[model samples]
Every structure is written in C-alpha cells, then in structure tokens.
Target chain A: MEVVKKYSETELVQLLQQRSGNVFSYLYDNYSGALYSVILNVVNEEELANDVLQEVFVKIWKQIDSYDSSKGRLFTWMLNIARNASIDMVRSKGFQNSRQNRELSEDVYSAGGTSETKTDQIGLRKVVYSLKEEYRVLVELSYFQGYTQDEIAKMLNIPLGTVKTRLRTALIQLREIIKP
Target chain B: MDIKAYIESGVIESYVLGMAESQEAAELEQLSRQYPEIKQAIDEFEAALEKQSLAAAIAPPAGVKEALFSSLESEFKKDRSQGQVASINWGRYLAAASVILLVVSSALNIYFYNQFKSTSTAYQSLLAEKNTLIAENQNTQTKVLDLYNSMQMMSDPTVIKISMTGIAGKENNLATVFWDSKSKDVYLLPNKLPDAGANKQYQLWAIVDGKPVDAGVMGTCAGLCKMKNIPNASMFAITLEKKGGSATPTMDQMYVAGKVG
Candidate 1:
C-alpha cells in the first residue's frame, strides 16, 4: 500500500502522540534532510551537522510530550531548536574553524539543479561579508550561532542594548548592500 | 511617530533572525505585533539565511540517530510516567558508583594505617625503659668496685675504724659507718629503710654521745644506701627531710637512731 505523506503538522503531532514508530520513521525520513541542511549551514562540518541533526530529533522526542498546540506549529518550534543547535556548534571553537573559504560554495547550483540562482547565493554572501568585522561576528553569533541577541551580547561581554543596536545596524547595512 | 524610520531600520529583520538583544528583542516582538509587514520581512530574512546555510549541509554519522533516539525514548518514558528506564545502560552507573566507592575505601584505609601507628607508640616507650635500667646497673657495679678498694685502703693501721649500730627505737635501720679520722673520709652502708615516695629525700645525722650533728644528705634506697663522710661522731642515724635537705634534722621524725663507737 502506498503511504500518504502528511501536510498538516497537527496530524503529524497526533500521530507522534499515539507513539507510532512508523510515523516517527516517516518523520525522520522526510525532515531529517532539511534539518541536516540547517545544521550544516551553521556547523559547517558534515559530521558535526549530522551529530546536531541527531540531537535535534532526540530533543524533539524528549520535549514533544510538553508541546502545546497554542504555541504555534511544530515546524516553527523545530526550526527554532534546529537553528539554535546549529548556532551553538558555530560558537564552539571546533566549528568556528569550518567558516573559511568557498563563500556561497562558489560552484553550488552548477551541480544541484538547473535554476542557476547562484547569483542569489553570491548576493547573500556579499551582503554578509560586506558587514563590518564586528557586525559580522554579531551576525554570525545571531544567525549562524543561533544565539538570541542577549546571548550574543553576553557572549561578547557587551551591553544587551548594544547587541540590539549592532544587529539593527548590521541588518540595515545588509539591506542597503543587497538591495537587488 | 517616527514609525516609518523605525520600520526602515531592518532591526525587524535582525529580531526575526533571533539576533536582537533583550531591548531590541522586546522592541522587535512588540513591533512584530504593531506592523505585520515587519514580521513578514523577518520571515523573508529567515528564509534567505536558511537557504544560504542549507547549501552547506553535511551528512551526520551513522547510528548517531539511534543513540539519540534511545536516550530520548528513555527520558520521555521516564518523564511521562513513573517507571524507571530499563533500557538505560547499567555500565555507566556501575562505573560511577565503583569510582566513588574506591575513593571512600582509600580514605578509610589511610585512617586505619594511622590507627596502627599509635599502637606502636607503647612499644617505643617500653624500649626506652629497658635502656635506662641497663645504664643504671653498669654504674652500680663501678661503685661496688670502688668500695672494695676503699676497704683495702682503710685496713692500714694508720686509718681509724668505727662501728655504728642502730639504737632500740630504730632497730630496723642500721649502717656500717666506716671512717678514717686522719683522712676524714667515711662510708655509711644503710639497710632496712622504707622506699621513698615522690619528692621526699632521706637525710643522715651524726651523734656524739646523744648530741646530733650534721652528716651529709643520703640518697634514696629501698634496700641499701651508701653515703660518704663521717664527722668524727659516735653515732649515725637516718631522718626524712624535704627535697633539698634541712640544715638540721626534724628530731621527732627521725626514723633511725644509732651509735658509732
């Protein structure tokens, strides 16, 4: 029998609540790749990204019982968790070294598909690198490190308000640079 | 309201990216409610960053998923209900407990070793007593040899000899009081005196026809005490005195009375 893929997150969560392994297996098979994609973006190491992927799923399993439907969708929550885990790795000394070279993979979609949206990749990389060195670190901490602005401020030992200001400044600079 | 400038700042984008400090985070959260457009812009920024980073995705290690699931499954089951996790590895707990036990036993072993050390202290004290007695015996032998030589010298016809015997009131205490009148040297061999107690000393007295004269103080002895010097007296007696000795004996407390003739 052909299995129907789930589109509604609520049904997926209900299936998870019933403690069904098939639903979990399907969930892993489907979202694992996307989660790994998020992990790789921040950790930049295939092995570490994979490790984070496992952690992300495990965390979901442990904390799933506590999920409330009122707190938005599972996708949003998962994204936050995945993003946070990925960023955590980037902040670590081990993953920090993985940030060098091959800006935007240079030759990325020449192989992945025919869309040739590589220009967008180039623009994003240029926008990020265009940020001042301090702003770049702040951006990396916020975006790639998955740290909240307060976390960024504390990690950098700066004022909480300054983190917000720098983030505002950096995003404004990026918007100007990548106006296209 | 400078609302247009605030919206233009792209702080909304940073807030959506989870990059805002608390002040900014709070401002952005409030603004996300104020302007749905700001929220929409944040979503767009999030999507772009996601796509950009997704290109760098790497495959994780094999079986890591299994390990994570196992831990999560245990944690979830134990949390949702009350039963202990049977599937949890016993080796980890056992290893930790064993390490703690080893530390405690090591400390206990040190405590016992110190206890054994105090028991040896008594053995050290007994060994000290044996050494003291050995030295005392050697000194006494030398004194006896000197007394024999003195007797040989006093046998000369020129040396005077006197015999001192205890009086009736002190029959149990007597001394062979020898004297050389010309040399003024004497030896008092005292026996039958009670043993001394802590801090009390014995004194000797010389009597010339019932008048007591001073003889040097004598050392303590339960058996025999030998004292030197005789002051041409007809009698020798023993008395107890203070530690150093009194200038004169306590006549009423005299333990032994003797006459030397």
Candidate 2:
C-alpha cells in the first residue's frame, strides 16, 4: 500500500492526539511495511510476523503520548519501538531456534530509503560499512539492535571507554559520508 | 560545561543514539537547552537514526489499514460518543447533604426544646404512650415463636449436603445438588455459584454413566434454592444451557461434574 503520505511532525502528532484515522493511516502507509519487514526478518516466520505487526499498532495506540517530536522524528521513535518488540519476539523461548536461517539484519538495510528520511544515521551503513571492524561492530550493536554502549562493550569483549571512543569515531565517519 | 566542546566530543550523539547512561543523557538533555546547537546536533542525530531505521518497515496485510482505522474508531469513539461527563464528587455532595441534615435536625431540636418548655408534661406523656404500645406488642410475641420454628425446620441441615467445586479454570463456576434424600428433592447451594449474565442460566444434569440427562433448570436463589425430586443418579453436572434447558444435557458446555458414589 503506497499510502506513505507527507505530513509535518507537529500536524501528524496533533492528529495522533485526536487519534484520527488520518494519523493511523499515515502510520500504516509509512511504517507498516517497514515494520512488517523488520519483524519478519527477526522472527523469520510469517505467523509471528503478522502477530508482531498487530502488536506494533497496539503499542502505538497505548503509547501515543510517549512520542515527542522534540527528541526525534516520528519514524525513529516508532522504529525503536518496533525493533524492541521484534527483539522480544525473537528472544522468547517459544520461538524455535534455527528458523532464522537468512541474516535478518540485512533486511533492515534492504528496505529502500526509509532511513534516508531521518538525519542521525544518514548514510549510516555507508560510513558504518567503511568503519574499522571495532567501530562497525559497535555502530551496528548500538544503533540496529538498540544495545547500550556498556552492553556493546561486554558483547564485543572490550572496555567501556573503548566503546565510547569507537562510537564517537563511528559517528564522525557517518557524518563525513552523509554530509551532502 | 563547555557546550561546543561537549557537542564536539560526540557525547550528545551517543546520548541521541540511547547509548549514553542516564547521567550523561540527563546532562546532555539539560545542556541542549543551554545551547541550541547541542539541541540541533541531537535532533540531527535523531533524524538520521529515524532514516536508517525506516529501512525495517514491511508491508502489513491487505486489510491492516482498514483494521487499524476500524479499531481506532471503536476505541477512540468510546469517549467521544459518551461526551464528557465531568464527574461530580459524590463524596462532597454527601458531605453537604449531611451538613444540611445536621442543621435541619438541630433547628428542629431547638424549636422542640422551646415548645417542651411551654408544656413539659406533653413530651413525658408522649413517651409514656409509646412505651405502652411497645408493652402491648411484647405481650403478643408468643405467636411469632411458632412461625420462626417452621422456618427453622425448612432450613434445617437434614437438608442434604452434596459437595461441589468449580470447573477447572472456571473457579467461579459451582454446582451442588443438595438433596433432602427423604423428600427425593434437591436444593442448590447457589450461594456458591458465581453470578451469570442476563438470559443466561445454569442447568443441572443427572448423568447416568457418561450420558447427561436433564434434571432441571436452576432457579435463582439468594443463597439457597429448593427443587423437587432429583432423580437418583451416580453423578451430577452443571452446564450453561438456554434460558430454560434442553431435554437432554449438552456435554460440551458443562461447567462442573463429579460422581456421587
């Protein structure tokens, strides 16, 4: 459904405060496909993908008030929510292992220019792709999987200070790459 | 804190990405107000993350948009349909009512006190008259004893007791057929059963072997009810049947069952 209509952040939020269909339609048009793809990638099963899709909207309804344009764009906030939910689905013991045969993270970058709409990770993959292994891994863990740098440090078997350094340099590389 | 140096340090970027600890995030959030550039930097970082994350979206089902809108209408309409009823505090109303009652009673008390001063004997005489009526009622109390005795015999425990429990996962459901085996009658201890909704009623079944035969549709009991002549059977069942009942038991919706033997 190519319903991804344009709306300013404030107008969209006001519509959401009213809980208008226009707002949810905008959400469906813009985010549903991307989130569905995200969830499908993580859970790697169609049924759970559908379930997570339903759950994502339910979360949006329940948590509409939590979104703040001052912090970031609507898509970033929603992506964070969708990612966390999909991760929860993957982590649940009920999900059989080995079902996720293909790399799910690749699907994250494959969905055309949805990420280009926001600013922070502009050419994130481009810069990240060029990053040294340490910085690249840190950027992936911190941004994609929503891991805190502290957690990334432990996962990457590095010191916390080094994580902060890698993340800083990684963002520099991303800035240079995405700088118009 | 030097805001430009701090922003250049890329700590705000880390904070925007949610990799910063609470203290660092709080500090950055605080400093972002002091310097708009830091705020702008953080906002830019947030925007970029949004763009990058947008890569994850997948097309939902064909009707998901319709489902979302319909659900939104249903959920959001509850408040709009009922227009806002600004709830009045009933407690405050009760307090005002009690104060009004207190003032009225006190005024009446004062007026009565002044009247009593004019003829004190009238108040004494009225009280004496009320005592005489009470004494007359006390003299006729013996007949009430006979009626109370009849009620005791009817409610007596020789009223048979059959044990019952709720269906598994339905702890509120209960069925007990208390038979006055001598009278071949049944009394359901409905006090134990959870309440059901309108037009919904529980039907009792007398099961012979595995088959359920209808016994009777239970009548509402404040706590207890008496039904006549329950067939002697090995087991009793309760099912959510129609307003009345089926001639035979419906096995699927049976709420509770246990054997008498």
Candidate 3:
C-alpha cells in the first residue's frame, strides 16, 4: 500500500483543476479508500460498493468544474458526490430487485459492529456505539445514509424540530466522546 | 450574537454533514465568513467527521486502481495523439504556405482599396464639419448682439431685479423677474422648480390694485422669457396650472411670490 503525500488544499485544487496525472494518483491513493468505505456502508455489499466507487470517481472527474472552494472542503465535496452515487445505486430498481428476499434493517449500518474495521475506526466506532440508540440512529441516517432533517423526521415519525435538536445533541455527544 | 448558542444549535453539524438545505447552506457559508467562531466550529466538526471517515477507510480492491489508471493512461495517450497531429508537418506546411502567399497578395489589395475609400469618406466629412462651423459662427454673433442689449438695460437703474422665493412645499424653488418700469416690460428667469409633468405649466400673476391680473403663461421654464408687463403691480406670484395657462390662477398652487420694493 502506498501513502499519498499530503498537500495544501490550494495546491491540490490547482492540480485537480489541471487534471494532472500525479494529482490523480495522489487523489486515488488518499481518498479512494475512505470513499469506498462510505459507499460500502450505504450499499452493504462489496461488489456493488466497488461498482459505485468506480462510477463515483468517474462522475467526480467529469464534474470537476462544478466543485467550488468557498462552499466546503475538496474531500467534503467529493464525499457528498460519493454518498449520493451510492445511495442512488441502492435505490435503483435493479438493486431493490437483487435484494427482494432480504428484509433491510432500519439500522443496517449497526451490523458493521463485528466486521473487520480499521484499528483507528474501531475506536471511533466504539464512541459511536456508546452514544444512546436515538442519537446513534440520527447520526446513521444523517451522516451515513445522507438523509435530510425533514426526511429523517418523516422516516422516524418524529417532529422535524425534534429531529434537528436530536441530531445536534448527537453531535455534542460525539464531540465529548472524541475530544482529546 | 451568541456564537456559542449558534454553534450548539447543530446547524453547523448538519451543514458539515451535508444535511443542510440549500438556503441554510448558503447562510452557513456567509456566517463562516462573518464570525471566526462559527468558522472554527465548522472546521472542528469537519475535521472530526473526516477522522471518522478515514478510520473506516477500506483499501479498494487492488484491481480497481489498475483499471482506473489504465483508462487514464489511454485518455492521456488520446490527448497526445491529437496534439501530435497539430505539430508542424513540413510537406503540408509547404503546400499551405504557397496558397497563403496567393491569398495574402489578394487580401493586401483589398485592404489598401478599403484604406483609400475610407480616406476619401473622411475628407468629405471634414468639409461638412467646416460648413457647420461657419453657420455656428453666425449664430454666436446673433447671441452676442442680444447679450449687449440686455447688458445695457441691466445697467439702467429704471429696471428692477425682483427676487422670488419659494412658498410652502416648493421651498427650494426660486425665480427672478426683471421689471423695466419705464418700458413696462417683464422678463421671467426661472432658477429651479420641482419638475412639473408634461401637461402642467407655471403661470405668472401680477397683484394690481388688490386684484390678481394675468401676467403671462411661462412655457418650458426655459431661459429669460417675456411676460405680460403690469407697470402698476405691487407684487408678483407664480402658480401651477393646466397646460396653456388658465383663465384664473389656481390659488392653492402658488409656488413662489415676491413684492417689488
């Protein structure tokens, strides 16, 4: 495994804009894994995750013009694109048909508890697990599944305001858990 | 602004996590610039989420990279091949050069022909400008002659310059009425007034023997213009009325008044 050298956001953005080979390699080495993880969490299948990751990167390369620095980080922007692509894949008729026999758990992500996760990730996962069930579900729906506050509220049969405040409390709990 | 309360509101977290609506996201972008604390809170939450994502990072299947980079290499090669065609080709350049020389000679002929035509057109315009200048000289001479006569009248003590001040709503308006009592000639010079609409006009009234008499209708409120002379009037007033003046002054529309001393 090769470690991608770190770059300032400015330098990375310039290289990405120029579509440099060196920068593309660096981006792949640094971000592809984290992006793959996000996709895997959403699709819950290694093969579909692989396909979605490839599709996401292609979309990123094609839509590089739409990326803006003022809106957020490069990684965050890429994360957003990756999350949407994965969620879209799982929502497609093909994906639903493939999984027609299995009952999809409302909190399917919690099952990753016993999977072979990274050592550092295990610590973070522990922090996530320590959060109350309500807080954890909000984090999962919002962070992993990419559900909006309104969507989360509708899905859980909760008020929109309560969903917003609960998500805030969950983040506060996360801050307390992960604080140095 | 309670920066702490704003941070605690979880809107920043929602924004960072890509859960904020379009409008709320725009506001968060603006707030980050306005408040350093909001910016810092956003940065911290982003860093925390980034860490969590990184920890769960799964090295993609090894074949995926081999697949992705090969496609990238093919794209690079395609670009290079397209660039290669654009590089100088001596044989093609020699053929193009001879054709270009022939075209260049014809283009030069057309260019010079246009230059000559435009020069003649410019010369004709200059002659027209000279004619206009001559006419303007005659017009200026007439104006100078009128000014000389007006200056002669101004120096005469018999002609009085009455200053009219604006009244009520038209407080900023002003005008001057030059009265030559010996000749009974009244000239109105408007300084400023609220612009009346196209159908409105300012009418002048002379106070003669405790009764209002029509002085004249002032049209367009332009330069020093003649008005009906009332040699025995004690005071003068201006009123806004319908276009072409009115039979009687609209008393409530009186904009300015002055008493001759």
Candidate 4:
C-alpha cells in the first residue's frame, strides 16, 4: 500500500465540500487503483473500463456534495458510484455492440498486463487470488456488479435466502483471506 | 440485542456488498445505529472487501489522472475569475465614493475660502474708516480749544488787540495781533492772505522804537500762534519770505501793517 497522507473523515468531508483540488488529487492517487479494479471487473474490457473509470471520477467530482457521511465510509460511497457507472456503461448499446465479439466468460483481470508482472510484488493481491472461484464469483456479482440480493438470486437462479447466505459466506471467506 | 443472531442474519455482509434491498438496507442502518455489534460486523466485512479490491488494483492509464486534474483545475480557475469580478465591483464602488468625497470637500473648501476672504476685506475697510474718523475728531477738538482761548483773550481789557489790514496793494489780506503789555507777550492770528508760493512762507516783524525786529514765520494759521515778544515795539508788519525766515525783513514784500494804540 502506498501510504498517502491520511485525513480524518470529518476533514476529508469538509475538504470535499470546499472542492479542494489537492484533496481530490490525493483521493485519485490513493483510491483510483481500487476503483479501477472494480470498474475493470464489471465491464471486463480495458478500453471500456478506462472510459467508465473516467466517468466515475467525473461524477464523483461533480456530485461530491450529495455524499452523506452518516450513511457509510467515503470509500464505500465512491465504490458504489464506480460500480453503478460501470454497470451503466456495460448496459449501453455502444458497449454491447463492441463487446459482442468477446466471450462473457473471459477473465476480468487478464487485460491489465501489469497485474501479472506485479502480482508477485504485492502480497495482498497474491493472497486474494487464493480465494476459491465459487466464492470469488459471488463476491464479484454482489459487490463489484452492484447486484441486489434478489437480482443476484434471479440471475444465478438460486433461492433468495441462498443468495444472502452465499454472499455472507463469500465475505467471510474473503475476510479470512484478507487477514494478516 | 443478540449479537450472535444479528451476525448470523447475513445483513451485515449484504450491506457491505451493496446487495441489500432498500428496506433491508434501511432496517440494517437503523440496527447499526442501535447496535454497535452490527456496525462493527459491517465495518469488518467492508474492510475485507476493500482488501480484496486493493488486491485487484490495476494502475489506471496515467492519462486518466491528468485528464481528471485538468478538468478540476479549469473549474477552480473559473471560480477564481468570478471571485475577482466580484472584488472588482467593490473596488469600483470605493473609487466612486472617494471621488465624490474629494469633489464635495474641494467645493466646500473653495466656498469657505471665498467667504473668509470677503469678510477680511470688509473688516480692513471698516478699520481704515474708523482710523480716519478718529484723526478728524482730534483735529476738531484742537480747534475748539484754540477758539475758546482766543475768546478769553479778547475779553481781557488789558491785552491790546491790533487789527492789521493788508498793505502794498494787497487790501483783502488781513491779520490780528494781540499784545499783553504787562506780560510782554505777542500773539499773531493770520487771517486772509494770498496763498504762499512753494518754498515761501509768511513772516511777521515787530518795530521796536522804529527799528524792524524779526518775529517768526507762520504757515496757514487757523488758530492763535505766539510771536516773539518785543517790549518796546510800537508797530508790527507781515511780509512773505523763503521757507526758512530771513535775518531781516523785506520791507517791500510787506502784506499787512498795524500800529499800537
């Protein structure tokens, strides 16, 4: 982790309200990687993910005032924006027309060439890859795709109760893998 | 609150993954606010999810960060320009106010200065008039005292008063001589006489037992003037001479003559 300078949540909120560019730049430097990963995971294409990533940041900058600190962490709100923007992009006609040539089952992380070379350099990335495919796919659909439990159940053709249990199990497994 | 039952409900995980239904999310938000255990569970799951996302972190194309920053910079620059315009408006107001103040003060200064100058001129003229009146009043007072003394002299019986009529073809010129025999004092009062030329004055002479003795030169005499006393003088005469009187009288220049009775 690149230990960027940290600000308290209150200070961060105030800075964002002021629309301070320095804070925004610091936010881009620290969180863009994670946001890009979530974006890349949803759209599963490099060019599409890049376009979606830009839209996500622009929306965040333009609509930062709507963020409510009481609702969730700043990162969580940004993640929701990124996931929603990526999902919206994936549904667009242009993306559908362009992406029809590629199979849906293609690996999401296979496009970023640096991920393969740098996977060994970062310990957390190697640890997360050890996550079982069954639970990883559940985490992806629920978290990165912004799918509601009902939607996830219908899409996966599982019971509504099973969708919740499976997402919970996926989170627990990820928690185990993420622990130091 | 049963922390174990709440943890087993999978609501925390659903909330963390953004998979919770609107109602479920609302209920979880309320529960989290009420129960610290639910909040803690959600935070833990969120942390795990964040970790997993970070693991998948791909350095975004470098161009995206530049593009995002440039957009923000342009926005801030736009805001600053508007701010400058606002500040410029206040500057214009201040400049106009100061100009008005300067104009008003200058006009007031000119008005007051003109008033003061006119008042000072009036005061100077009034002071000059008062000085001239004081001088004239003093001259009048001197004349009144002289006339009063002359009246007293005329009333004394012992004082000899002689009226000298103009002689030498000058009949209109007249003079008076008052003699106090006991005190041997003589006073001449020059009356009508031709105007003296420049550098010339009227001189009076006394005849002491027939010889002429110089008395004194006289100017325009509107009052009594004491002449030199000649105790044995039998007659007196007036003649015109240079500004400073001569050693001897010019008998041919005699304008008036009188004899003691």
Winning model by lDDT: 3
Q: How high a TM-score does candidate 4 get?
A: 0.64
The TM-scores, one per candidate, come to 0.39, 0.47, 0.53, 0.64
**What ranges in model 4 sit over 4 Å off?**
A1-7, A10-70, A89-103, A107-129, A145-168, B1-11, B30-36, B47-158, B167-172, B194-197, B207-212, B219-222, B247-254
Of 2 and 4, the candidate ranking higher by TM-score: 4
Top of the candidates by TM-score:
4
lDDT of 3 by residue, B35-110 (tens): 9899988877776667666766789898887777776676544443444555646657877998999899889999
Backbone steric clashes in candidate 4, count:
0
lDDT of 2 by residue, A13-126 (tens): 777777665566666677777666655544556667677777788888778888877666676667667667877776666763544443544433433443222322332444
For model 1, residues B203-233, the per-residue Cα lDDT tens digits are 7777766676667777643223345566567
Ranking by DockQ: 4, 3, 2, 1
DockQ of each: 0.15, 0.17, 0.22, 0.39
**Candidate 1 to truth, TM:** 0.39
Show where candidate 1 strays beyond 4 Å: A1-5, A17-20, A65-73, A87-135, A145-166, A172-180, B1-7, B30-35, B38-62, B66-261
Indicate the residue-level lDDT of A94 in model 3: 94
Scored by lDDT, model 3 comes in at: 0.77
Cα shift from native, residue B64, model 1 (Å): 3.9
What are the runs in model 2 whose C-alpha is more than 4 Å off? A1-6, A34-50, A96-127, B51-73, B76-261
